[model samples]
Target: MKITHYLYNAFLIESGDKKLAVDPGGLMFYYFRFSPLIPKSEWNNVTHIFVTHGDPDHYWHADRMAAVSKAPVICNKTMVQEIDGKYLLLGPRDKGVAFTTEFKNHHKLSVDETIEVDGVTITGIKTTHGPLTVKLGPFSKTLNPGRDERIGWGAIGFKIQLDGKTLVNLGDTLLHKDEWESIDSPDVLMIPIGGNAVHNTMDIPEALQAIRIMKPKLVIPCHYNCPAFFSKNFNHADEDEFRNELEAMDIQYAILHKGDSIHV
Candidate 1:
């Protein structure tokens, strides 16, 4: 099996006749500026696309890629409704964003459901997106304090079984203990190592704890080190620090740059 990283959480996995792309959103400035890590020409071979949530950075290029490749989009129910047959408006909240010229079909998967598409077995796993807090102008408010928020658009993780190998991609999530029992040990585990301290996703320490719990043979750190347009200073979590922690735990990991590929 071969896996290629396309910056942030976007990845392409190829094994035998199957080609699956996960979280193909790459057009926004929060993730990338002008071009995708993997060019448009490389997307033609994609057979299936998986989206973890409704976040713009993760769903931006999904429709476009699906239109060209005619690949079915696998995503959460809400995300499927958001872009089912309508053009996507890309921008800040309420200001209206740019729209895509194409539309594609979306397949919604709930947590704990398994589906087979294009020779790949995909199972959705439950995940949380942390506390909900929003900032408006100079004021910040907690929209989901106490028990109001339900974790970032009902987010989910993916357990992909292909070519006799099991791979798990935990979208943006907080470290939850229950998920360990639900998912089997994976050959490759892709997780987010940023935003734990900030209450949006798992930070380095929490991610290390998750690594210990999942016990995957290979671990890949993602959802960090991308450019942010709203802020003047670009903030990124350190993969080297994550590597050091992983080494201390005797866990194997691969730190991939944008567009880097590895075969396992």
Candidate 2:
């Protein structure tokens, strides 16, 4: 199988004619910062679209991709809810999304749920979204970080089994209690390593700790290099540090530039 990186957490996985894309982001918060990496011709045949969470950077063009491929959007139940504004219980805004789509081929899953697509099996893994924000000062002049709460409602990771190899993609999340221990070692793991006071994703130290626990054969980092204008808190740490740490620990890893491919 071959994997192609498409900036942020977006990835294109291909084995033979079966193509699966994860998180293909859309324009930057209605701006035009991010454009498509894979041509429409390629994404049109994607057999499955997987979304780890509902951030625009993670799920902007998914509905259209599903429409083109006629494949199911396999994701955690929270993602499915966001697709339809099910209960309007998403994000900091209690308000519901303006419009929604039916996505006739949607697949709503939960932690520990498993689904098979074509010949590949996808297992849902538990993941905690970044910390919630607490309003501070008048008119929300400041922000305070809340406790590390496992996003009980709206986030997830995936253990994908394709062509006898496993790939784990943990969307935007922080280190969770014992959650990393539950995932079996995969051939490759995609994790987040861009975090700080303004953000809730993992920093380098936490990522190294996760690797020590999961012990995957290879590791790839994601959820970084976002434009500051998109979200002030949107941040990224240096991958050089992560690369150096992996080398010191004797772990194999790859830092893919956009459109780069790797095989296992």
Candidate 1 ranges with C-alpha deviation above 4 Å = 27-37, 81-104, 131-151, 230-235
Residue clash pairs of candidate 2 = none
Best by TM-score: 2
lDDT of model 1 at position 151? 31
Q: How high is each candidate's TM-score? A: 0.81, 0.82
Local accuracy of candidate 1 as per-residue lDDT tens digits, 1-264: 999987768899988877888887654464336345456887898888887864556766666787788888776654432467563432212122233333455566788889887678888888877764444478776534222233355378889999899999988788887766766569999998767434667888888878778888999998776655454222258877888888988888899977788899
Runs in model 2 deviating more than 4 A are: 30-34, 81-99, 131-153, 228-234
Candidate 1 Cα deviation (angstroms), residue 191: 0.3
Model 2 scores a TM of: 0.82
Give Cα distance to truth, residue 117, candidate 1, Å: 1.2
Please give the TM-score that candidate 1 achieves against the real structure: 0.81
